[model samples]
Target: MTPRGVLGADELNNIAVFKAVSPSVVNITALGLERDFFSLNVQQVPQGTGTGFVWDTQGHVVTNFHVIQGASGARVTLADQSSYKAELVGAFPDRDIAVLKIPAPVAKFKPVTVGTSRDLQVGQKVYAIGNPFGLDQTLTTGIVSALNREIESVTHRTIKGAIQTDAAINPGNSGGPLLDSAGRLIGVNTAIYSPSGASAGIGFAIPVDEVNRIVPRLIRDGRMVRPSLGVTGGGPEINRALGLPKGVALVRVQRNGPAAKAGLKAFSRGDGGILAGDVITAVDGEPVETQDDMLTALERLQPGDSCTLSVWRSGATRKLTVTLAESDD
Candidate 1:
């Protein structure tokens, strides 16, 4: 028989999680200068407060891209309300992760433990610890609702493989840690999917795998380099006749783009004179149903990826293998 007042394995675990991670979670407050012509003077505006976690012992802190955005001055407030002035180290607006440098001495820093996002499963219990609305180290709980979400980033680019949760994340939770049941930081809470400008019980986080891929590169190169095919083509049906197969009309190709390098021909006769069009049926064994699918398939590619393209030309099917090139532009 179970004891009358004893706690189970879950309750004790929650308390342990709270104790383990709350200290590493921090509150980031940004202050900005506003120029007011009415007063003919500049005033400091309390920009906002967001959450970030300690990324390393060297005092590098990580948070959302929108957190320290446009920040002219900033500070980090710890659990005890102890504050430290922070400097911008680097930022990745595409991935929504920004690294900040705090001047806090080594003795004052407690690096948070990093966790992998690859192992997360839907319906798993998770928790959020953050300084929502300037409140320090508050805790909220929920479960992983979904995975691998493609969301519009603050930079207007699509960020792939994000974590989705029903965890009540709000305005101040950006850059905070989305922890697993064991108190490990699995995802960095970044955005909320809401129409009312408030938490509708839906939140999104940047997957740690993305952080792992980007953070080091940002630290070294100060930017993320993405490989691209450098070809643009697509329109409604290419205005074909009633019975003919639909095709995408290419207007132009980059001087040395992948398609150009592959020596693929572009239309240039009557109704196609040098008009430069290629009817793409497939790419690297993947069917291209729409423009977005092609873009998405090419999105995560790195340099040196070999791609075979299936094109319909002169009423014939042919395949061409092209080795992708790096785009510095």
Candidate 2:
């Protein structure tokens, strides 16, 4: 074979990026408990494998919650092939993000450089390093195919503002880091649009902006403490049956809660029939047509923060300022 000439600028950049970022990527092995039918003995067995990256020198590792879902425990294998038993720190399954901690020394870690996803273009270059099919440390390159895509989480909640790429994300690639050309983490590879359970050149990643927002809270509280309005609303079907406006129709409002204190009335059954209630059409000028939209908007604010809600009632609309409260959900 003829000797290859000096590499091009792009090739050199790819090489540099792979070398710089590969060390931050790690392989995750999920372990589950299984009972032997004959002896009835419970044993820890390998459930699955995925990818993750170092979040900090304190041994915090971030990965998809689904990657370790239902597993009894997990193990993290660093770039040096050193494995350590990991402890679950926290998880926000609504966004498919989880944090694990390893007891490895601080000197053994190299956290990936974090980048923002708010300004990603549709055609910017992106790179993915993951353990596809359990083969660790594989690198694939592609571009941002789309932006602002949405995907469902394990909790059946909508994860908005996802980043779509053609970066060859395979099954084992879940929870891996999706980096930009500068070797900065832009997203965390989560899912793919494939029928055969392989890379179909259509992959989705949780945007790093969301990750950066949720990870810290998870680390601090062990879960995402979403802000709530203390009002139970009807779903789309119920809203449609009631002929309500394009917003959440309050079905029940907790007494003395934020919504109730704000004078938001709930639907009631009168002598004639079901009476109309206040339907929230917007939050602080942001239109919310569904419950998920309302939740998404509220997630942007903190508990105790005051916001204006556009409430629609019989033939009239009014704005109500209500204080948000922390939710257990």
Candidate 3:
């Protein structure tokens, strides 16, 4: 008979991570109003389920925006089986991140230890704690498959610097913490590249560096402070259709806006046809091939910050300086 004693080093490490972080993880049940087809009456019903983690001892919970989207309200269940009603504090669909507040006591809100994603290496062991498929308190293990990957957000915007892992993130795992072996939060498990809506060994997470930047602003202002250059352009599809190189083509520049103020040219109607406008190829030496890239580049700066734009205009390329401004939206 095999003798049972202390666990192996790896087994012990995995168990230790689970024990430390599980208390911070919580299961979320979102409710929404639905109409009955026959009676034509609206009633509250269970909309969906997802996972979240405690952000602080103040009862603030962080989850994916889609988790509570279209739902009237939600409830958070802790590892101790204590449940509390959650109120939507703020949501930034561009990042698939949302903050919720519960009235639970501070003692019940054990915040997870945060970690930086900037130094993560491929093949490093990682952990994902969430309620996958509605199975609460489930833990999955995997290594960092890749880093600095780009994924689309719920708002159809690009989420840059995403950490790719094979951590078995499923439907219900959205918004849970993707932790390192030390049980520190490195990213928020968001989406999985699967046709069947399962893990499929490819999962993505929003890097904690960005979450660290956006969440505090959401908590304080209820919105992310995304500075804009005030230039109008289409997506990558329009850029490709126009036969232009990889860059955003300025269709119209807002008057008195940052782009206009910086003397950025806009498209003009000519005798032959519509004349091309200045195409922004890079921002502050960072190459931006698509509008998503431009937006991501601009996100690194704040309003009133000066940025240099490498623009192609009228068969000539030149650098233009622009001061960013707050988005009207």
In the order shown, the candidates' Cα RMSDs to the true structure are 4.2, 1.7, 2.5
Model 3: per-residue Cα lDDT at residue 217: 84
Give the whole-model CA lDDT for all candidates, comma-separated: 0.78, 0.93, 0.89
- For model 3, what is the alpha-carbon lDDT of residue 68? 91
Q: Which stretches of candidate 1 lie over 4 Å from their true place?
A: 1-4, 36-43, 133-135, 233-251, 264-329
Model 1 lDDT per residue over 221-240, tens place: 66655555666655546535
TM-score of each: 0.79, 0.95, 0.91
1 against 2, candidate with superior TM-score: 2
Pairs of residues at least 3 apart in sequence or in different chains that clash in candidate 1: 268-272, 268-273, 268-274, 269-272, 269-273
Considering every candidate listed, which one attains the maximal lDDT?
2
Q: Weakest 10 consecutive residues, lDDT, candidate 3?
A: 131-140
Instruction: Indicate the residue-level lDDT of 287 in model 2.
Output: 92
Ranking of all candidate structures by their TM-score, best first: 2, 3, 1
